[model samples]
Target: MTVVQVSAGWVPLAAALLLTVATAAAALDGVLAARAGGRPLGEGLLTPAAETARLFRQRRRTTVAADLPLQRIGGAGLLTAALLMVTVVPFGRWTVADLSVGVVWFNAMDVLLWAALWLAGWGPNSVHPLVAGHRFLAQALSYELPLMFALTTPAVAAGSLRLGDLVAAQSGLWFVVWMPVAFVVFCAGVLAFSAWGPFSAALGGGATGGVLAESAGVDRWLVTAGRYALLTAGAAFGATAFLGGGHGPLLPAWLWVLVKTALLLAVLVALRRRLPVVRPERLTVPAWLVVLPLVLVQLLVVSVVVVVRG
Candidate 1:
Protein backbone atom coordinates (compact mmCIF):
# COMPACT_ATOMS: atom_id res chain seq x y z
CA MET A 1 0.00 0.00 0.00
CA THR A 2 1.13 3.53 -0.72
CA VAL A 3 2.09 5.54 2.31
CA VAL A 4 -0.24 8.42 3.15
CA GLN A 5 1.21 11.71 4.29
CA VAL A 6 -0.51 14.85 5.43
CA SER A 7 -0.12 17.40 2.65
CA ALA A 8 1.73 20.59 3.46
CA GLY A 9 0.08 23.96 2.91
CA TRP A 10 1.52 24.30 -0.56
CA VAL A 11 0.54 20.78 -1.67
CA PRO A 12 -3.01 21.56 -2.81
CA LEU A 13 -1.85 24.70 -4.60
CA ALA A 14 0.88 22.73 -6.33
CA ALA A 15 -1.56 20.02 -7.32
CA ALA A 16 -3.87 22.63 -8.79
CA LEU A 17 -1.04 24.11 -10.82
CA LEU A 18 0.05 20.63 -11.88
CA LEU A 19 -3.49 19.96 -13.08
CA THR A 20 -3.34 23.15 -15.16
CA VAL A 21 -0.15 21.93 -16.83
CA ALA A 22 -1.70 18.54 -17.37
CA THR A 23 -4.73 20.25 -18.90
CA ALA A 24 -2.52 22.17 -21.27
CA ALA A 25 -0.60 19.06 -22.18
CA ALA A 26 -3.86 17.24 -22.84
CA ALA A 27 -4.98 20.08 -25.11
CA LEU A 28 -1.68 19.95 -27.00
CA ASP A 29 -1.96 16.20 -27.35
CA GLY A 30 -5.49 16.62 -28.68
CA VAL A 31 -4.28 19.03 -31.32
CA LEU A 32 -1.62 16.51 -32.25
CA ALA A 33 -4.16 13.73 -32.47
CA ALA A 34 -6.30 15.74 -34.88
CA ARG A 35 -3.41 16.72 -37.16
CA ALA A 36 -1.23 13.61 -36.91
CA GLY A 37 -3.52 11.31 -38.82
CA GLY A 38 -1.77 10.85 -42.19
CA ARG A 39 0.21 14.01 -41.58
CA PRO A 40 3.48 15.25 -40.04
CA LEU A 41 3.53 14.94 -36.24
CA GLY A 42 5.46 18.19 -35.73
CA GLU A 43 2.57 20.24 -37.07
CA GLY A 44 0.18 18.55 -34.69
CA LEU A 45 2.43 19.15 -31.65
CA LEU A 46 2.71 22.89 -32.29
CA THR A 47 -0.96 23.60 -33.04
CA PRO A 48 -2.01 24.21 -29.46
CA ALA A 49 0.84 26.62 -28.87
CA ALA A 50 -0.04 28.51 -32.02
CA GLU A 51 -3.69 28.63 -31.08
CA THR A 52 -2.89 29.81 -27.56
CA ALA A 53 -0.76 32.67 -28.83
CA ARG A 54 -3.44 33.65 -31.28
CA LEU A 55 -6.10 33.65 -28.59
CA PHE A 56 -3.84 35.60 -26.26
CA ARG A 57 -3.29 38.28 -28.89
CA GLN A 58 -6.97 38.58 -29.75
CA ARG A 59 -8.97 41.46 -28.30
CA ARG A 60 -11.95 41.13 -25.94
CA ARG A 61 -15.27 41.92 -27.50
CA THR A 62 -18.09 43.89 -25.93
CA THR A 63 -21.52 42.31 -25.96
CA VAL A 64 -24.39 44.75 -25.82
CA ALA A 65 -26.52 44.31 -22.65
CA ALA A 66 -24.66 41.11 -21.72
CA ASP A 67 -24.49 40.08 -18.10
CA LEU A 68 -20.76 40.60 -17.58
CA PRO A 69 -20.66 39.04 -14.13
CA LEU A 70 -22.36 35.86 -15.26
CA GLN A 71 -20.26 35.75 -18.43
CA ARG A 72 -17.02 35.96 -16.46
CA ILE A 73 -18.21 33.44 -13.92
CA GLY A 74 -19.27 31.02 -16.61
CA GLY A 75 -15.96 31.29 -18.43
CA ALA A 76 -13.89 30.89 -15.27
CA GLY A 77 -16.22 28.31 -13.71
CA LEU A 78 -15.03 25.65 -16.15
CA LEU A 79 -11.53 25.81 -14.66
CA THR A 80 -12.96 26.26 -11.20
CA ALA A 81 -15.03 23.08 -11.46
CA ALA A 82 -12.07 21.19 -12.86
CA LEU A 83 -9.77 22.33 -10.05
CA LEU A 84 -12.37 21.51 -7.42
CA MET A 85 -12.79 17.96 -8.74
CA VAL A 86 -9.06 17.26 -8.33
CA THR A 87 -8.92 18.21 -4.66
CA VAL A 88 -9.41 14.58 -3.65
CA VAL A 89 -7.46 13.06 -6.53
CA PRO A 90 -4.23 11.62 -5.14
CA PHE A 91 -0.91 12.20 -6.83
CA GLY A 92 1.39 9.43 -5.66
CA ARG A 93 0.20 9.26 -2.04
CA TRP A 94 -0.86 12.90 -1.75
CA THR A 95 -4.26 14.48 -2.24
CA VAL A 96 -5.37 18.05 -1.66
CA ALA A 97 -8.39 17.52 0.54
CA ASP A 98 -8.47 13.71 0.85
CA LEU A 99 -12.01 13.87 2.16
CA SER A 100 -13.67 10.74 3.58
CA VAL A 101 -16.35 11.29 0.96
CA GLY A 102 -14.03 11.83 -1.98
CA VAL A 103 -16.32 10.07 -4.42
CA VAL A 104 -19.17 12.39 -3.47
CA TRP A 105 -16.80 15.31 -3.62
CA PHE A 106 -15.93 14.40 -7.20
CA ASN A 107 -19.59 13.96 -8.02
CA ALA A 108 -20.46 17.32 -6.52
CA MET A 109 -17.87 19.11 -8.58
CA ASP A 110 -19.04 17.33 -11.74
CA VAL A 111 -22.59 18.37 -10.96
CA LEU A 112 -21.40 21.96 -10.99
CA LEU A 113 -20.66 21.69 -14.71
CA TRP A 114 -24.37 21.95 -15.44
CA ALA A 115 -24.48 25.38 -13.89
CA ALA A 116 -21.17 26.49 -15.34
CA LEU A 117 -21.97 25.63 -18.94
CA TRP A 118 -25.53 26.84 -18.70
CA LEU A 119 -24.53 30.16 -17.24
CA ALA A 120 -21.86 30.49 -19.90
CA GLY A 121 -24.19 29.71 -22.73
CA TRP A 122 -26.87 31.98 -21.33
CA GLY A 123 -24.54 34.82 -20.46
CA PRO A 124 -23.91 35.60 -24.07
CA ASN A 125 -27.63 36.23 -24.68
CA SER A 126 -27.22 34.77 -28.17
CA VAL A 127 -29.57 32.22 -29.67
CA HIS A 128 -26.84 29.71 -30.45
CA PRO A 129 -25.18 29.83 -27.02
CA LEU A 130 -28.60 29.65 -25.35
CA VAL A 131 -29.32 26.55 -27.40
CA ALA A 132 -25.95 25.16 -26.41
CA GLY A 133 -26.67 25.69 -22.74
CA HIS A 134 -30.03 23.94 -23.05
CA ARG A 135 -28.40 21.10 -24.94
CA PHE A 136 -25.89 20.56 -22.13
CA LEU A 137 -28.70 20.30 -19.60
CA ALA A 138 -30.43 17.72 -21.79
CA GLN A 139 -27.14 15.89 -22.22
CA ALA A 140 -26.56 15.89 -18.47
CA LEU A 141 -29.84 14.03 -17.88
CA SER A 142 -28.61 11.30 -20.20
CA TYR A 143 -25.18 10.77 -18.63
CA GLU A 144 -25.27 11.90 -14.99
CA LEU A 145 -27.26 8.99 -13.53
CA PRO A 146 -25.22 6.36 -15.33
CA LEU A 147 -22.08 8.16 -14.28
CA MET A 148 -23.22 8.07 -10.67
CA PHE A 149 -23.93 4.34 -10.93
CA ALA A 150 -20.56 3.73 -12.55
CA LEU A 151 -18.80 5.55 -9.73
CA THR A 152 -20.85 3.62 -7.19
CA THR A 153 -19.35 0.33 -8.29
CA PRO A 154 -15.89 1.29 -7.06
CA ALA A 155 -17.16 2.80 -3.84
CA VAL A 156 -19.23 -0.31 -3.21
CA ALA A 157 -16.22 -2.55 -3.80
CA ALA A 158 -14.02 -0.47 -1.54
CA GLY A 159 -16.85 -0.04 0.94
CA SER A 160 -15.81 3.57 1.38
CA LEU A 161 -15.97 6.90 -0.39
CA ARG A 162 -12.39 7.80 0.45
CA LEU A 163 -10.29 7.89 -2.73
CA GLY A 164 -7.13 6.72 -0.99
CA ASP A 165 -9.00 3.77 0.44
CA LEU A 166 -10.36 2.97 -2.99
CA VAL A 167 -6.84 2.96 -4.42
CA ALA A 168 -5.73 0.71 -1.62
CA ALA A 169 -8.58 -1.72 -2.30
CA GLN A 170 -7.37 -2.03 -5.88
CA SER A 171 -3.92 -3.23 -4.88
CA GLY A 172 -4.96 -6.79 -5.64
CA LEU A 173 -6.88 -6.02 -8.85
CA TRP A 174 -7.69 -2.91 -10.82
CA PHE A 175 -11.40 -2.03 -10.81
CA VAL A 176 -11.39 -1.51 -14.60
CA VAL A 177 -10.69 -5.19 -15.20
CA TRP A 178 -13.61 -6.27 -13.06
CA MET A 179 -16.10 -3.58 -14.02
CA PRO A 180 -15.46 -2.90 -17.70
CA VAL A 181 -18.98 -1.61 -18.37
CA ALA A 182 -18.80 0.80 -15.46
CA PHE A 183 -15.40 1.98 -16.65
CA VAL A 184 -16.70 2.54 -20.16
CA VAL A 185 -19.74 4.35 -18.87
CA PHE A 186 -17.61 6.46 -16.55
CA CYS A 187 -15.31 7.38 -19.44
CA ALA A 188 -18.32 8.33 -21.51
CA GLY A 189 -19.52 10.48 -18.63
CA VAL A 190 -16.11 12.11 -18.53
CA LEU A 191 -16.50 13.08 -22.16
CA ALA A 192 -20.04 14.25 -21.55
CA PHE A 193 -19.09 16.44 -18.61
CA SER A 194 -16.09 17.90 -20.38
CA ALA A 195 -18.04 18.35 -23.65
CA TRP A 196 -15.33 16.38 -25.36
CA GLY A 197 -15.45 14.20 -28.51
CA PRO A 198 -18.74 12.44 -29.18
CA PHE A 199 -20.38 14.14 -26.21
CA SER A 200 -19.52 17.70 -27.32
CA ALA A 201 -23.08 18.68 -28.15
CA ALA A 202 -22.72 21.96 -26.28
CA LEU A 203 -20.34 23.31 -28.89
CA GLY A 204 -21.73 21.37 -31.83
CA GLY A 205 -20.79 22.28 -35.39
CA GLY A 206 -24.42 22.12 -36.36
CA ALA A 207 -25.06 25.44 -34.65
CA THR A 208 -21.86 26.97 -36.01
CA GLY A 209 -19.95 26.40 -32.77
CA GLY A 210 -23.03 26.42 -30.52
CA VAL A 211 -22.03 27.84 -27.10
CA LEU A 212 -18.92 29.26 -28.69
CA ALA A 213 -20.72 30.90 -31.61
CA GLU A 214 -20.79 34.43 -30.23
CA SER A 215 -17.67 34.19 -28.08
CA ALA A 216 -14.47 35.71 -29.35
CA GLY A 217 -10.96 36.70 -28.15
CA VAL A 218 -10.30 35.99 -24.47
CA ASP A 219 -13.84 34.88 -23.79
CA ARG A 220 -13.49 32.07 -26.28
CA TRP A 221 -10.02 31.29 -25.00
CA LEU A 222 -11.14 30.79 -21.41
CA VAL A 223 -14.10 28.60 -22.42
CA THR A 224 -11.91 26.42 -24.64
CA ALA A 225 -9.16 26.09 -22.03
CA GLY A 226 -11.68 25.31 -19.31
CA ARG A 227 -13.18 22.45 -21.34
CA TYR A 228 -9.76 20.87 -21.85
CA ALA A 229 -8.94 21.35 -18.18
CA LEU A 230 -12.12 19.49 -17.24
CA LEU A 231 -11.03 16.67 -19.55
CA THR A 232 -7.63 16.48 -17.78
CA ALA A 233 -9.29 16.29 -14.38
CA GLY A 234 -11.62 13.51 -15.57
CA ALA A 235 -8.68 11.49 -16.91
CA ALA A 236 -6.83 11.86 -13.60
CA PHE A 237 -9.92 10.90 -11.62
CA GLY A 238 -10.42 7.82 -13.84
CA ALA A 239 -6.79 6.82 -13.30
CA THR A 240 -7.25 7.05 -9.56
CA ALA A 241 -10.68 5.41 -9.43
CA PHE A 242 -10.00 2.58 -11.90
CA LEU A 243 -6.31 2.13 -12.79
CA GLY A 244 -5.02 1.40 -9.27
CA GLY A 245 -3.96 5.04 -9.17
CA GLY A 246 -0.19 5.36 -8.79
CA HIS A 247 0.39 1.69 -7.92
CA GLY A 248 3.28 0.27 -9.90
CA PRO A 249 6.85 -1.05 -9.58
CA LEU A 250 10.28 0.39 -10.50
CA LEU A 251 9.30 4.03 -11.12
CA PRO A 252 7.94 6.47 -8.57
CA ALA A 253 4.19 6.41 -7.94
CA TRP A 254 3.82 10.00 -9.12
CA LEU A 255 5.18 9.07 -12.56
CA TRP A 256 2.70 6.23 -12.84
CA VAL A 257 -0.14 8.65 -12.08
CA LEU A 258 1.04 10.94 -14.85
CA VAL A 259 1.49 8.09 -17.32
CA LYS A 260 -1.93 6.61 -16.73
CA THR A 261 -3.65 10.01 -16.81
CA ALA A 262 -1.86 10.99 -20.01
CA LEU A 263 -2.85 7.73 -21.67
CA LEU A 264 -6.51 8.29 -20.81
CA LEU A 265 -6.34 11.93 -21.87
CA ALA A 266 -4.85 10.93 -25.21
CA VAL A 267 -7.59 8.42 -25.83
CA LEU A 268 -10.25 11.03 -25.03
CA VAL A 269 -8.60 13.52 -27.36
CA ALA A 270 -8.16 11.04 -30.18
CA LEU A 271 -11.81 10.11 -29.88
CA ARG A 272 -12.74 13.60 -31.09
CA ARG A 273 -11.22 12.74 -34.43
CA ARG A 274 -12.61 9.22 -34.56
CA LEU A 275 -16.30 9.76 -33.79
CA PRO A 276 -18.90 12.15 -35.09
CA VAL A 277 -20.48 14.57 -32.63
CA VAL A 278 -23.37 12.78 -30.92
CA ARG A 279 -26.61 14.72 -30.83
CA PRO A 280 -28.24 15.15 -27.45
CA GLU A 281 -31.63 14.11 -28.82
CA ARG A 282 -30.25 10.86 -30.21
CA LEU A 283 -28.44 10.04 -26.96
CA THR A 284 -31.40 10.52 -24.58
CA VAL A 285 -33.09 7.21 -25.33
CA PRO A 286 -29.92 5.12 -25.39
CA ALA A 287 -28.56 6.69 -22.23
CA TRP A 288 -31.75 5.90 -20.35
CA LEU A 289 -32.62 2.60 -21.96
CA VAL A 290 -29.24 1.03 -22.71
CA VAL A 291 -26.30 2.58 -20.75
CA LEU A 292 -28.23 3.24 -17.55
CA PRO A 293 -29.42 -0.37 -17.17
CA LEU A 294 -25.98 -1.73 -18.02
CA VAL A 295 -24.35 0.47 -15.38
CA LEU A 296 -27.07 -0.43 -12.85
CA VAL A 297 -26.38 -4.12 -13.46
CA GLN A 298 -22.69 -3.48 -13.01
CA LEU A 299 -23.47 -1.80 -9.72
CA LEU A 300 -25.71 -4.71 -8.73
CA VAL A 301 -23.05 -7.26 -9.55
CA VAL A 302 -20.51 -5.30 -7.53
CA SER A 303 -22.83 -5.00 -4.55
CA VAL A 304 -23.50 -8.74 -4.60
CA VAL A 305 -19.79 -9.59 -4.86
CA VAL A 306 -18.95 -7.31 -1.96
CA VAL A 307 -21.73 -8.94 0.12
CA VAL A 308 -20.52 -12.45 -0.73
CA ARG A 309 -16.96 -11.58 0.17
CA GLY A 310 -17.99 -9.76 3.31
Candidate 2:
Protein backbone atom coordinates (compact mmCIF):
# COMPACT_ATOMS: atom_id res chain seq x y z
CA MET A 1 0.00 0.00 0.00
CA THR A 2 1.07 3.60 -0.58
CA VAL A 3 1.98 5.89 2.31
CA VAL A 4 -1.47 7.48 2.20
CA GLN A 5 -3.13 4.08 2.29
CA VAL A 6 -0.96 3.02 5.20
CA SER A 7 -1.79 6.24 7.02
CA ALA A 8 -5.42 5.75 6.26
CA GLY A 9 -5.31 2.23 7.65
CA TRP A 10 -4.35 3.49 11.11
CA VAL A 11 -7.51 5.59 11.29
CA PRO A 12 -9.83 2.77 12.23
CA LEU A 13 -7.49 1.25 14.81
CA ALA A 14 -6.97 4.65 16.37
CA ALA A 15 -10.69 5.30 16.37
CA ALA A 16 -11.27 1.95 18.03
CA LEU A 17 -8.75 2.79 20.77
CA LEU A 18 -10.31 6.19 21.31
CA LEU A 19 -13.73 4.59 21.48
CA THR A 20 -12.48 2.18 24.14
CA VAL A 21 -11.20 5.02 26.25
CA ALA A 22 -14.36 7.06 25.72
CA THR A 23 -16.59 4.17 26.73
CA ALA A 24 -14.50 3.59 29.85
CA ALA A 25 -14.91 7.24 30.65
CA ALA A 26 -18.64 7.08 30.04
CA ALA A 27 -18.95 4.06 32.30
CA LEU A 28 -16.94 5.90 34.93
CA ASP A 29 -19.03 8.97 34.44
CA GLY A 30 -22.14 6.93 34.97
CA VAL A 31 -20.63 5.67 38.22
CA LEU A 32 -19.76 9.17 39.34
CA ALA A 33 -23.18 10.44 38.45
CA ALA A 34 -24.76 7.78 40.58
CA ARG A 35 -22.37 8.45 43.47
CA ALA A 36 -23.04 12.19 43.41
CA GLY A 37 -26.69 11.36 43.69
CA GLY A 38 -25.90 9.39 46.89
CA ARG A 39 -25.78 5.94 45.35
CA PRO A 40 -23.15 3.27 45.91
CA LEU A 41 -20.07 3.27 43.66
CA GLY A 42 -20.89 -0.24 42.57
CA GLU A 43 -24.42 0.90 41.86
CA GLY A 44 -22.97 3.78 39.88
CA LEU A 45 -20.72 1.64 37.72
CA LEU A 46 -23.16 2.10 34.88
CA THR A 47 -26.33 0.05 34.45
CA PRO A 48 -24.33 -3.13 33.95
CA ALA A 49 -22.29 -2.54 37.08
CA ALA A 50 -25.36 -1.98 39.18
CA GLU A 51 -26.89 -5.11 37.76
CA THR A 52 -23.68 -7.00 38.56
CA ALA A 53 -23.82 -5.90 42.16
CA ARG A 54 -27.40 -7.04 42.39
CA LEU A 55 -26.53 -10.43 40.99
CA PHE A 56 -23.56 -10.82 43.34
CA ARG A 57 -25.60 -9.89 46.39
CA GLN A 58 -28.33 -12.33 45.60
CA ARG A 59 -28.06 -15.90 46.81
CA ARG A 60 -26.52 -18.25 44.32
CA ARG A 61 -29.64 -20.14 43.62
CA THR A 62 -29.22 -23.45 41.92
CA THR A 63 -31.78 -25.91 40.69
CA VAL A 64 -31.46 -29.40 39.32
CA ALA A 65 -33.30 -28.09 36.29
CA ALA A 66 -30.56 -25.64 35.20
CA ASP A 67 -27.75 -26.21 32.75
CA LEU A 68 -25.00 -24.43 34.68
CA PRO A 69 -22.33 -25.00 32.07
CA LEU A 70 -24.43 -23.57 29.28
CA GLN A 71 -25.18 -20.40 31.24
CA ARG A 72 -21.50 -19.74 31.83
CA ILE A 73 -20.70 -20.54 28.24
CA GLY A 74 -23.38 -18.18 26.98
CA GLY A 75 -22.15 -15.23 28.99
CA ALA A 76 -18.59 -15.83 27.88
CA GLY A 77 -19.76 -16.29 24.32
CA LEU A 78 -21.35 -12.84 24.21
CA LEU A 79 -18.10 -11.24 25.27
CA THR A 80 -16.13 -13.26 22.74
CA ALA A 81 -18.48 -12.37 19.94
CA ALA A 82 -18.25 -8.69 20.75
CA LEU A 83 -14.46 -8.87 20.78
CA LEU A 84 -14.35 -10.73 17.47
CA MET A 85 -16.58 -8.15 15.85
CA VAL A 86 -14.26 -5.40 16.95
CA THR A 87 -11.30 -6.95 15.22
CA VAL A 88 -12.61 -6.35 11.71
CA VAL A 89 -13.92 -2.85 12.33
CA PRO A 90 -12.13 0.11 10.73
CA PHE A 91 -11.86 3.05 13.05
CA GLY A 92 -10.91 5.73 10.56
CA ARG A 93 -8.62 4.55 7.79
CA TRP A 94 -6.91 1.96 9.94
CA THR A 95 -8.25 -1.46 10.85
CA VAL A 96 -6.59 -3.91 13.20
CA ALA A 97 -7.13 -6.62 10.62
CA ASP A 98 -8.50 -5.39 7.35
CA LEU A 99 -9.56 -8.09 4.95
CA SER A 100 -11.24 -8.10 1.58
CA VAL A 101 -13.85 -10.17 3.32
CA GLY A 102 -14.29 -7.73 6.20
CA VAL A 103 -18.02 -7.59 5.68
CA VAL A 104 -18.24 -11.37 5.62
CA TRP A 105 -16.17 -11.56 8.78
CA PHE A 106 -18.69 -9.30 10.49
CA ASN A 107 -21.58 -11.48 9.41
CA ALA A 108 -19.76 -14.61 10.52
CA MET A 109 -19.13 -13.21 13.98
CA ASP A 110 -22.87 -12.64 14.45
CA VAL A 111 -23.41 -16.41 14.49
CA LEU A 112 -22.20 -16.40 18.07
CA LEU A 113 -25.44 -14.68 19.06
CA TRP A 114 -27.40 -17.91 18.85
CA ALA A 115 -25.00 -19.89 20.99
CA ALA A 116 -24.59 -17.15 23.55
CA LEU A 117 -28.28 -16.43 24.07
CA TRP A 118 -29.22 -20.11 24.11
CA LEU A 119 -26.65 -20.82 26.75
CA ALA A 120 -27.82 -17.92 28.90
CA GLY A 121 -31.42 -19.10 28.78
CA TRP A 122 -30.88 -22.83 29.13
CA GLY A 123 -28.18 -22.66 31.75
CA PRO A 124 -30.19 -20.57 34.22
CA ASN A 125 -32.81 -23.28 34.65
CA SER A 126 -35.37 -20.63 35.60
CA VAL A 127 -38.58 -19.70 33.89
CA HIS A 128 -37.85 -15.98 33.60
CA PRO A 129 -34.32 -16.36 32.32
CA LEU A 130 -35.30 -19.16 29.99
CA VAL A 131 -38.20 -17.18 28.67
CA ALA A 132 -35.92 -14.19 28.08
CA GLY A 133 -33.40 -16.32 26.24
CA HIS A 134 -36.08 -17.82 24.04
CA ARG A 135 -37.30 -14.33 23.38
CA PHE A 136 -33.83 -13.27 22.32
CA LEU A 137 -33.57 -16.27 20.04
CA ALA A 138 -36.84 -15.38 18.38
CA GLN A 139 -35.85 -11.73 18.11
CA ALA A 140 -32.52 -12.66 16.59
CA LEU A 141 -34.20 -14.72 13.94
CA SER A 142 -36.28 -11.71 13.00
CA TYR A 143 -33.58 -9.05 12.90
CA GLU A 144 -30.43 -10.83 11.79
CA LEU A 145 -31.61 -11.52 8.27
CA PRO A 146 -32.64 -7.92 7.68
CA LEU A 147 -29.44 -6.64 9.23
CA MET A 148 -27.35 -8.71 6.83
CA PHE A 149 -29.38 -7.54 3.87
CA ALA A 150 -29.01 -3.93 4.99
CA LEU A 151 -25.25 -4.31 5.20
CA THR A 152 -25.19 -5.59 1.64
CA THR A 153 -26.53 -2.27 0.40
CA PRO A 154 -23.24 -0.51 1.09
CA ALA A 155 -21.17 -3.42 -0.15
CA VAL A 156 -23.10 -3.33 -3.37
CA ALA A 157 -22.50 0.37 -3.78
CA ALA A 158 -18.78 0.21 -3.03
CA GLY A 159 -18.28 -3.02 -4.94
CA SER A 160 -15.98 -4.35 -2.25
CA LEU A 161 -16.19 -5.98 1.15
CA ARG A 162 -13.08 -4.23 2.42
CA LEU A 163 -14.27 -1.47 4.74
CA GLY A 164 -11.21 0.63 4.03
CA ASP A 165 -12.03 0.61 0.37
CA LEU A 166 -15.56 1.56 1.17
CA VAL A 167 -14.36 4.60 3.10
CA ALA A 168 -11.91 5.57 0.43
CA ALA A 169 -14.66 5.47 -2.16
CA GLN A 170 -16.44 8.21 -0.25
CA SER A 171 -13.89 10.88 -1.11
CA GLY A 172 -16.59 13.27 -2.18
CA LEU A 173 -19.86 12.01 -0.80
CA TRP A 174 -20.83 9.56 1.94
CA PHE A 175 -22.92 6.49 1.24
CA VAL A 176 -25.68 7.76 3.49
CA VAL A 177 -26.63 10.31 0.86
CA TRP A 178 -27.25 7.70 -1.81
CA MET A 179 -28.43 4.87 0.38
CA PRO A 180 -30.51 6.55 3.06
CA VAL A 181 -32.80 3.59 3.39
CA ALA A 182 -29.90 1.19 3.89
CA PHE A 183 -28.43 3.57 6.44
CA VAL A 184 -31.69 3.49 8.37
CA VAL A 185 -31.76 -0.27 8.12
CA PHE A 186 -28.19 -0.49 9.36
CA CYS A 187 -28.96 1.69 12.36
CA ALA A 188 -31.99 -0.39 13.18
CA GLY A 189 -29.87 -3.53 13.03
CA VAL A 190 -27.34 -2.04 15.41
CA LEU A 191 -30.07 -1.13 17.88
CA ALA A 192 -31.49 -4.63 17.69
CA PHE A 193 -28.10 -6.29 18.12
CA SER A 194 -27.32 -4.17 21.13
CA ALA A 195 -30.76 -4.94 22.55
CA TRP A 196 -31.43 -1.21 22.54
CA GLY A 197 -34.89 0.34 22.62
CA PRO A 198 -37.72 -1.05 20.53
CA PHE A 199 -35.80 -4.30 20.19
CA SER A 200 -34.97 -5.01 23.82
CA ALA A 201 -37.25 -8.03 24.12
CA ALA A 202 -34.36 -10.05 25.45
CA LEU A 203 -34.06 -7.61 28.32
CA GLY A 204 -37.72 -7.18 29.24
CA GLY A 205 -38.65 -6.02 32.74
CA GLY A 206 -39.92 -9.27 34.32
CA ALA A 207 -37.01 -11.52 33.38
CA THR A 208 -34.36 -9.92 35.60
CA GLY A 209 -32.75 -8.25 32.57
CA GLY A 210 -33.17 -11.31 30.41
CA VAL A 211 -30.13 -13.47 29.52
CA LEU A 212 -27.79 -11.61 31.83
CA ALA A 213 -30.38 -11.56 34.60
CA GLU A 214 -28.69 -14.17 36.73
CA SER A 215 -25.15 -12.95 36.18
CA ALA A 216 -23.37 -11.23 39.07
CA GLY A 217 -20.23 -9.26 39.94
CA VAL A 218 -17.53 -9.37 37.27
CA ASP A 219 -19.70 -11.42 34.96
CA ARG A 220 -22.23 -8.65 34.75
CA TRP A 221 -19.52 -6.06 34.34
CA LEU A 222 -17.98 -7.96 31.46
CA VAL A 223 -21.33 -8.29 29.73
CA THR A 224 -21.99 -4.58 30.09
CA ALA A 225 -18.48 -3.60 29.03
CA GLY A 226 -18.75 -5.84 26.01
CA ARG A 227 -21.99 -4.13 25.09
CA TYR A 228 -20.40 -0.68 25.09
CA ALA A 229 -17.60 -2.04 23.00
CA LEU A 230 -20.13 -3.50 20.63
CA LEU A 231 -21.90 -0.19 20.37
CA THR A 232 -18.64 1.55 19.62
CA ALA A 233 -17.92 -0.98 16.93
CA GLY A 234 -21.32 -0.49 15.39
CA ALA A 235 -20.93 3.27 15.41
CA ALA A 236 -17.50 2.98 13.85
CA PHE A 237 -18.90 0.76 11.12
CA GLY A 238 -21.68 3.22 10.39
CA ALA A 239 -19.28 6.12 10.33
CA THR A 240 -16.87 4.31 8.08
CA ALA A 241 -19.51 2.95 5.75
CA PHE A 242 -21.77 5.95 5.47
CA LEU A 243 -20.54 9.04 7.27
CA GLY A 244 -17.31 9.65 5.32
CA GLY A 245 -15.10 7.63 7.67
CA GLY A 246 -12.21 9.84 8.75
CA HIS A 247 -12.54 12.33 5.97
CA GLY A 248 -12.95 15.94 6.91
CA PRO A 249 -11.47 19.06 5.35
CA LEU A 250 -9.90 20.88 8.32
CA LEU A 251 -9.76 18.37 11.16
CA PRO A 252 -7.36 15.50 11.66
CA ALA A 253 -8.49 12.00 10.68
CA TRP A 254 -8.75 10.87 14.27
CA LEU A 255 -10.81 13.90 15.24
CA TRP A 256 -13.18 13.24 12.40
CA VAL A 257 -13.60 9.69 13.65
CA LEU A 258 -14.23 10.86 17.18
CA VAL A 259 -16.76 13.39 16.03
CA LYS A 260 -18.65 10.94 13.87
CA THR A 261 -18.59 8.21 16.49
CA ALA A 262 -19.80 10.53 19.22
CA LEU A 263 -22.61 11.73 17.01
CA LEU A 264 -23.70 8.19 16.25
CA LEU A 265 -23.52 7.18 19.90
CA ALA A 266 -25.51 10.23 20.89
CA VAL A 267 -28.20 9.31 18.42
CA LEU A 268 -28.24 5.78 19.76
CA VAL A 269 -28.42 6.86 23.39
CA ALA A 270 -31.12 9.39 22.61
CA LEU A 271 -33.19 6.73 20.93
CA ARG A 272 -33.33 4.97 24.27
CA ARG A 273 -35.67 7.70 25.45
CA ARG A 274 -37.47 8.26 22.18
CA LEU A 275 -38.49 4.80 21.03
CA PRO A 276 -40.58 2.31 22.92
CA VAL A 277 -39.80 -1.37 23.02
CA VAL A 278 -41.67 -3.47 20.50
CA ARG A 279 -42.85 -6.93 21.26
CA PRO A 280 -40.62 -9.64 19.81
CA GLU A 281 -43.47 -11.26 17.88
CA ARG A 282 -44.47 -8.04 16.10
CA LEU A 283 -40.87 -7.39 15.15
CA THR A 284 -40.41 -10.84 13.68
CA VAL A 285 -43.08 -10.51 11.03
CA PRO A 286 -42.89 -6.82 10.14
CA ALA A 287 -39.12 -6.50 10.30
CA TRP A 288 -38.49 -9.44 8.00
CA LEU A 289 -41.45 -9.58 5.64
CA VAL A 290 -41.78 -5.83 5.31
CA VAL A 291 -38.80 -3.81 6.62
CA LEU A 292 -36.07 -6.10 5.36
CA PRO A 293 -37.59 -6.40 1.89
CA LEU A 294 -37.79 -2.64 1.63
CA VAL A 295 -34.13 -2.43 2.53
CA LEU A 296 -33.31 -4.83 -0.28
CA VAL A 297 -35.25 -2.67 -2.66
CA GLN A 298 -33.29 0.32 -1.42
CA LEU A 299 -30.11 -1.55 -2.13
CA LEU A 300 -31.26 -2.12 -5.69
CA VAL A 301 -32.03 1.54 -6.09
CA VAL A 302 -28.60 2.49 -4.81
CA SER A 303 -27.04 0.04 -7.19
CA VAL A 304 -28.91 1.59 -10.09
CA VAL A 305 -27.76 5.05 -9.15
CA VAL A 306 -24.17 3.91 -8.89
CA VAL A 307 -24.37 2.22 -12.25
CA VAL A 308 -25.87 5.24 -13.90
CA ARG A 309 -23.27 7.53 -12.43
CA GLY A 310 -20.50 5.19 -13.54
- For each candidate in the order shown, give its overall lDDT on alpha carbons: 0.84, 0.71
State the lDDT of candidate 1 residue by residue for 73-153, as single tens digits: 987888888888877888887777778999999999999989988888888888888889999999999999999999989
How does model 2 fare in lDDT?
Answer: 0.71
Report the alpha-carbon TM-score of model 2 versus the true structure.
Answer: 0.83
Question: How many backbone collisions does model 1 have?
Answer: 0
* Backbone clashes in model 1, listed as residue pairs: none
Instruction: Please write out the lDDT profile of model 2 over residues 50-134, one tens digit for every residue.
Output: 5556766765555666787777777666656666776665655455677788888877776677767777777878777788888
Name the best candidate (by TM-score).
1
Error of 1 at 80 (Å): 0.7
RMSD of each: 2.0, 4.4
lDDT of 1: 0.84
Number of the top-ranking candidate, with lDDT as the measure:
1
Q: Model 2 off-target regions past 4 Å?
A: 1-65, 205-207
Model 1 misplacement above 4 A: 2-8, 11-39
